[model samples]
Target: MGGPNLEVFKFGFYIMFPIGIMYYFGTNLDSKFSVDGFWPSKEQSNKIPTEPEDIRAELERLRRRRLERRATRLAEETRSQQDMAGDGA
Candidate 1:
């Protein structure tokens, strides 16, 4: 049978080994002195207007322009084909 001394040593080593390693490597004192403080007084502009209704209106205008251009191109293609057919017949 193992003695009580061996059991105590095993428990102490299991608990203290990780805490000792963490204490030794975790605290970096030199890097704490070299940090620059943040500038807290910078002026920033609110350039973007955050209106969803204005965005929706602009999107609808773009959609209408795109559909108008597509319809115009299709109508011009159809007219050219009709003119070519009439000239051949």
Candidate 2:
């Protein structure tokens, strides 16, 4: 290949190669900064609910919520029926 300025290109690579290698590894030379963010500082133990009374209370609350939702749906359905009857006139 009879390319002009080939010596300049060769010199540029020689100069930049060491800088690139340093940038790739020098800043992370410290072991502390090289790790990911998942290092734990606190207890990670799984906590299961320990009280039967708490479970019973939660169940009662959920049952109340379900009954309220059913009542609201039934009320809205009845209101839609009245609206349809009025529209048919």
| Best of the candidates, TM-score | 2
Alpha-carbon local distance difference test for all models: 0.83, 0.83
Q: Mind giving the per-residue lDDT tens digits that candidate 2 earns over 22-81?
A: 888777576736666556654665444569987788779889999999999999999999
What is the alpha-carbon lDDT for the whole of candidate 2?
0.83
Per-residue lDDT tens digits for candidate 1, residues 1-89, read: 68999999999999999999888776785575445555444455333436998788877988999999999999999999999999999
User: TM-score, each model?
Assistant: 0.44, 0.46
Q: Tell me each candidate's RMSD, in Å, in order.
A: 11.0, 8.0
- The residue ranges of model 2 lying beyond 4 angstroms of the native Cα positions read 1-48
Q: Ten-residue segment with the worst summed lDDT in candidate 2?
A: 40-49
| lDDT at 47, model 2 | 43
